[model samples]
Target: MSSTRFTDALTRLVDALPEPDDFPSTARNRELTARVGTWLGACFLLAFLTGVWSHLAQLPDPVLPLPTRPVWLYRVTQGVHVAAGTAAVPLLLVKLWSVFPQLFRRPPAVRRAQVLDAAERLSVLVLVSSASFQLVSGLANSAQWYPWSFSFRATHFAIGWVAMGALLVHVAVKLPVIRTAWLEPQGQPAQGTVSRRTVLGVTWAAAAVAVVTTAASGVPGVRRLSVLATRTGTGPGGIPVNKTAAAAGVARAAADPAFALVVAWGDTERRLSRADLEAMPQTTATLPIACVEGWSASGVWGGVRVADLVDLVGAPTGSAVLVESLQRVGASSRSRLPGNVAADREAILALTLAGEPLSLDHGYPCRVIAPNRPGALQTKWVSRLEVRP
Candidate 1:
């Protein structure tokens, strides 16, 4: 029968591929895979947690506000996020290569086992595809390039959840193998083309090289050394800008002499001009503007303390404030500052960056300079402050 012959040929094709049992089950292969996988898993966990924090912080009404005290919190987390993701490129390649031999492994013969095996393979495919997209897009974003039309944040965030979920499923499916491999006593690495030590040493060196090259954006001394470092150089006053005044369409209003910062509370309100703000006791704070795009710059900012501005309007001791920007559009044109950011003395409505008046590109007139907050949330060309909470 034609149908029976077709089934027989298909079965033959499946049997032709190497079985899983055919791959060398040496102590070295399992050990190497386990170690590399363990490191990769850790990187994913850190990137996910930090990413969630970033997402929540950017929300209009955050259920939980991130702390403002550490000052370098956002800077460190974002730096680590990029760094870990960068390191993953090489780690992933090595991991895939280590397991590539199993790709030829044949599927289960039993009906029940075949179904479970199919599911496991599907999970692995999802994990690999999502993770690959994340790394590619993340690196491309670092270079400020976009080849796709979709919203990077939304797409990446959704894929991140998918990737992590798939990763968990993959782990669950492989746990038995992982457990047995881990528990087995250390033994002489089975003879192979290369020693296990050599493979491990090369992998570690490759990852380290990748990290060091891309870390130039964060380390001043290595800036010249790291050509791959995406963010290098300054905007104005040696500080960087993610969105320029012209780009945000705030050039006209930002330069208008009639512009006054409107600060309001339930029953009290104050309109402070450039002079009024300058006349106030200016406090200085050093803060880094860390962007979600994986770039950052630091500068000395001097301006009215956030608490002092809140006090003028008679807001409660720890009232949350909504900051409005002169920019005409964009979701980040306005931002909400939780009580923690409002209460910090180091958090200021900055008029100047690095001793000079804020360059138009650097949020001219005034901008929020708070510790540990994302650069996008630091509303630029600040027009008004509403102490609603």
Candidate 2:
């Protein structure tokens, strides 16, 4: 059809649709949307920064040198990442509800304005859909619920860029309107109907409650209050276990009497039994196991330093190592530790937690534990540590 014909048809359709004013309420004004969107946008921005740090932290070769000090960095960042996302849910819902009437509002009469209006709506669609997916998928990931076959980290990371891009476009397009609505006093509520203040107050309360109830999986202080938390930061040996020995299909291997930790550099190799590893000079470091699933807990890890193990194999300083687990499945069966990470004094091949032998579920004979690293990268049930040339 010609542009004119399409425009005429659209006008007729919009005319037949319910008018925005038909469902008017003081709570559903531009001011209300602006207020709620301010909070939603803040949440998204915070999640974006923390999420980027998380993705970079898990990379096999990070572009930048992630710090090894302030051991609780990842724990705090990932915790905030999940909490900000949780808080965004209610704010998004309220923002959308406040602007629901715009979905059926009549288009602009001027051709240029009409085109801009269409573009704005399209951007809004992308922003809302992507934001919703991020929140839902993030929540599912926190609960360890994966209904889809694709990698959650990869997909979530990619969509996050898309969502943020669309959000910028939306904000740019509506800046003038946002400024006006945000600065101006809210219009009074229709007599006998709820005020905009009440709506906003309730929405803020809901967001606060959401964050408090779910973010406890990562924050120890609020763990009790977070009854809805997925992981209570507690498991065998006082540290939560994401994958159990039996589930990883490594129970037999990890418990085998012949089990040995193979440390190799080039052609040189050293096989150490649990006794051998324990006999070596031991170091203790309190480090947090900060999982991507948004839970973390610190344990006093006691073991031989990774630097010592590499030195035994004749691996030089500033060398990276690939840690291999006994598990026969999953991408997490192996993880690469960079040069700086390996060199850090706080990095260890942990044999004990809280001064007790490591539990089978927590990597049995030995596991890799390092400060300021994601728990996934802290390879568990370690069988081999090969130094990279």
Candidate 3:
């Protein structure tokens, strides 16, 4: 058989499948569903674009490989991903409610034709199921819980591709009807349409309010806006006490090295200890420590500007600075230095928390604070610094 003939045959086979017309009341429900779906699609597209851009920007040099991207970019994009996914929850629910009745519609024909129709419907079901799971699991992961054994990030990424593929197929199949619907008004009763508008307006307003409230709650002037307070516990630093127990708590055995300010000139290295650092002029700033896990705290940090530190040590510009943690072993632990230190100017070896010595869990002896990065990148337990070209 010719290729054209085979293609025509397949087209005919699919065209013979039964059509189901049990679409729900085209009243207010349909209009609301359309609006909600449009909003969600727009949000998802924005989030997708931002995420792709951030990932591309943080790509490491081809010569070196890292398990994750640089800390600052990763923190920003991860927050964006979580926030966008979280907002999609109610939008999706409203969309689903409007189209749910279509699930039980009866077909126009029976036999093999009906089987193909059912298969098409099944594809939609799979898309909805997988997308729903992805959203819920993502939300849970943001809350710092992993109920399933599988990695949420990896699984979520995989399922997102499947869902997008299925969605594209679905839209292709429905292009004609969708275009018609787009061109024509839903013709819902005026009162019903008004009610839907009210509902949607309220929903969007509430969502905006929630986001602003949550953000303000983290700041010192507006911390009251957030319902949850920052959590405190014995963290990685294990300071204000014994260094041995702190290392034991996080399951590491590392010596607590004295704080040092170092400068390298060609082959020779010059070093200044903690007393030398304290002898320099100091500046303090109050900032909030916001964790990706949805908890935040405010602290007053007193430290020399990282630029000042470099200058005091007489290090050259564009040099790499390594910030190590005394509370953990190896560079991979919570003590690990940030991946992109040269790009940031505000990175500091912090010495005080809320105007006092650092707390045990808060990196007691000394910690590195890089603004706008996740808590994970903020290494606790200061030990060493290596300046390099």
Candidate 4:
């Protein structure tokens, strides 16, 4: 069949189904849709910006070096990322419900209008599908649940661009309608149970509740209010661990009496036993293990400064280091520390937490704890540090 004829047939089939008129509701007006959409867009923008920063922060060679001061920068950004994403869940549901009837909208009779309608429908499909996947998968990641085989980080990052693009297109197409809804007052109230104001108020409340309940994953101050928090902010040394020695297959190796941290640069090498490292200068830094999964807790970490370790191997200041873990598996088994980060006095191969010897689950032998670094890159169960100038 010809393209026009095919379009007409599909339109007829869709029009035959229930129309928007059949699902009348006062909350289904353009004004309410616009308002909900505005809030949802703001959430998406915030999530996208922070997600980009997070992805960059995790890269072996970040596009830009992330900040290393204030100590709690990543903690705040990641916290906001998770909280905004969590809030989007409820806002998305309400936005979809407000415009659910649009799915049954009939194609226009004119070919020109029909083409525009088809384009709008396509944009909406992309927007909804991408937005839904991002929010749902993000929640799963925050909860540490992985039901899919694909890499969440890579997939989420790529789809984020698509979602943002679709969102921009949608806003451009609906700008006139949105502007009208925002500037003009609503006309006579529709004959329905809930008012537009009621729907909007309820949606805002739901979003707020969602954020408050889950924000403890990152913000410890809100832990009491966050009953639904993913992590309780309680673990070894008063900090949560994403991976334990048992889970990472490093339990026996970490406890071995002969265990030593090998620091190497070129032909020079030094193997320092646990006691030997303790004898060296100890520096304590209060740093937050700000997880990308959206939880964090601060602890007083004491250990040999990473700068000192590299210095033993004849490496000069501003030299980067590759930290290897006893972890035989997983992407976090080894991580690269940039030069500036390695030179930071606050960067240490921590041996003690809260003035107590490190727990096995908390990297007994040693772990890299640096300011403003993602928790995953902290390199727990540290076994080797290869310095590079």
Candidate 5:
């Protein structure tokens, strides 16, 4: 069928169905529900737009330089993306409560009943499922736990498409209800007429407040005020590591002779020593430490670049660099060496933080810093380096 015919048929099918009066609630509830639906729709739309932009920014060699986009802009957009999604939780609950009663009202069969019913059911399922997953997964990712092996970015990207498609179908199906409710005040016996404009204004104001507050507390620039900052050492998997330890480790490593700071790549069987690293030319860069937890701090790091170190050893391009931590247990020494280092070109066995020597918590002897990767990937307390192909 032509697009116009399909839309016309769909609209007629929806129009032929029972109206709000056919359900159990008063007119007031219907109006309130419609108003809430509008708010939720607005939030969803904002989230969808920002989410697409953020994901597009991750594309390699994008038309625009996304990283160079002012850090504040990134923070605001990301904050909105998260805030809109969080607000949807309560809005969806209210919307579902208001509309659920309509499900019980039966209507006569119309043209393409099977197709319409199937399409409606499928759309609802996708909408609910995708929204639920995105909200839950986003919360988990923010907490820094990967429940699924799949990359969060990839899953988020795919589910965003599903959510958008489902949203379109839902809007198409509910067009009549939205129009009627929007045009006329909700008239009910118990509750007087509700001004649509008032409802919309209040909802928009609430959403704005939510977004602003959340962003202020959680984004990098304003994160100092966040309650979460006060609760340190509480990362996922009971990882005792915290920002304090991370900062201290980097400081202590530089001054302590026992601390070994170097990047090594090659067979784990053959270990590289501190002498080996000193022989290579070192480069220092003041890079900001950006973490997924919405915290960011700049640190001055000094180390032989993994690429340079690998070249000194004559290792292949694809060889993995191993980093070691000074912390040891029993006979075995603790280290992050021999890990995959080939993934980044600027990976470094950092020896300094913010121009000072490493602190105890910050990987005193040495730590690995690979730009654009998670903090966990940057191992602390360097002791050994091994290259692997």
Candidate 6:
């Protein structure tokens, strides 16, 4: 069929669907849609910023070395990413429902108006799809479910860029209408059963409840309030571990009586048993393993400073190191630590957690715990440290 005929057929099919007398739409309340759009835009912006920060932290070469101080930085930022995303769900649904009628609106009489209107519709489609994928997959990642074949980290990060770009285009397209709506005074009760303000208030309240419930994953002090929190932040030794030694196939190696951490630096190397590691000068630092899964907890990690180990093998300060885990498989089995992480006094190959021996899953003998790093990069069951000049 010809393009015009095909378009008309699709339009007829769409219009045939029975829309209710009180169906939500922009025609019902343009001001309400604009307000929800504003709120939705803020949530997307916050989620993108915090998501980028998190992506950077996990990189082998950070955009800039993340700070070792204010130790709770990653926790708070990732919490905000998840919380903002959770809140955006309600806003996006409300905004889409409010604009439902626009999908079937008659085309503009003028050709220029028609073209601009079509472009706006396309942008909105891209925005809705991208934003929906982000929020849905993000929540799935939190639950540790792998329903798709694609890598969550790579796909999620790639789509985040697209979603933000579409969001910017959407905001620019609607700037005039948004500005006018913001400046106008609230409308008086429309002499209807319920007011628009009342609907908006209920939406905001639901979003607030979502934030409070899911926020426990990041904020330890509010753990009691987060009914939806997946990782409770408390486990064998005051922290939850994603993969157990048995799960990671590290139980045998980790429990070996001959287990020792081999530290290498250029021409020199040192092998130390559990006792030898403990014998070395041990200092304690409080750090949080702010995971991408969106849960974190602070633990008193006591062990040799990573810099101390680097120095032991005669490696000068600021040398990057390779951390090798006993686990045979997994993307993070052998993670590369940037020089800044190795030199940080706070970074350690921790032996004790919360004054108790490290759990097998938490890296029994020794594990790399660096500041401002993602939990996955916190290589557990570390058996070898290859220092680079």
- The digit string of per-residue lDDT tens for model 4 on 153-251 reads 889999999999999999999999999999995774857678887888899999999999887555556788898998788898999889889989999
lDDT of 2 by residue, 1-389 (tens): 99999999998886788978887576677888888998899999999999999889989988787989899999999998999999999999999999888897888899999998898888999999999999999999988899999889899999999999998888888899899987775666667368888998999999989989888566656788898989777888799899999999999999998999899998998999999998999999999999988889989999999999889988897799999999867878999889999999999999999999999999989999999998889999999999997
Taking the tens digit of each residue's C-alpha lDDT, what string does model 5 give over 63-93? Answer: 5433332324544566567777767876776
Residue 370 lDDT in model 5? 57
Query: Could you tell me the lDDT of residue 25 within candidate 2?
Result: 74
Which digits, one per residue and each the tens of the lDDT, describe model 1 over residues 18-108? Answer: 7666766343377788878878888887878878777886877777777786888788788888888888888888888788766776777
Cα error, residue 147 of model 6, in Å, equals 1.4
Q: Please say which candidate is ahead in lDDT: 4 or 5.
A: 4
Clashing pairs in 2: none
Stretches of candidate 2 exceeding 4 Å from the true structure = 1-16, 186-192
Q: In model 3, what lDDT does residue 159 have? A: 77
TM-score of candidate 2 on Cα atoms, chains taken together: 0.94
Superposition error at 152 for model 3 (Å): 3.7
C-alpha TM-score for every candidate: 0.90, 0.94, 0.65, 0.95, 0.57, 0.93
**Which 10-residue window in model 3 sums to the lowest lDDT?**
233-242
If both were scored by lDDT, which would come out higher, candidate 3 or candidate 6?
6
Off by over 4 Å in 1: 1-28, 185-191
Q: List the residue pairs that clash in candidate 1.
A: none
- Candidate with the larger lDDT of 3 and 4: 4
Candidate 4 whole-model C-alpha lDDT, 0 to 1:
0.90
Error of 5 at 344 (Å): 8.6
Off by over 4 Å in 4: 1-16, 188-190
Candidate 6 per-residue lDDT over residues 1-389, each given as its tens digit: 99999999998997886554436432347688888889999999999999998888877767677777677888888878888999998898888877886666777899999999898889989989999999999988988898999989999999999999999998888888888888984574447666777779978998988888875556656788888878666887788888888889989999898998899877687899999999999999989988887788888899999998888888889999999999879877988888877899998999999999998889897898988777889999999999987
C-alpha local distance difference test of each model? 0.84, 0.90, 0.56, 0.90, 0.59, 0.85
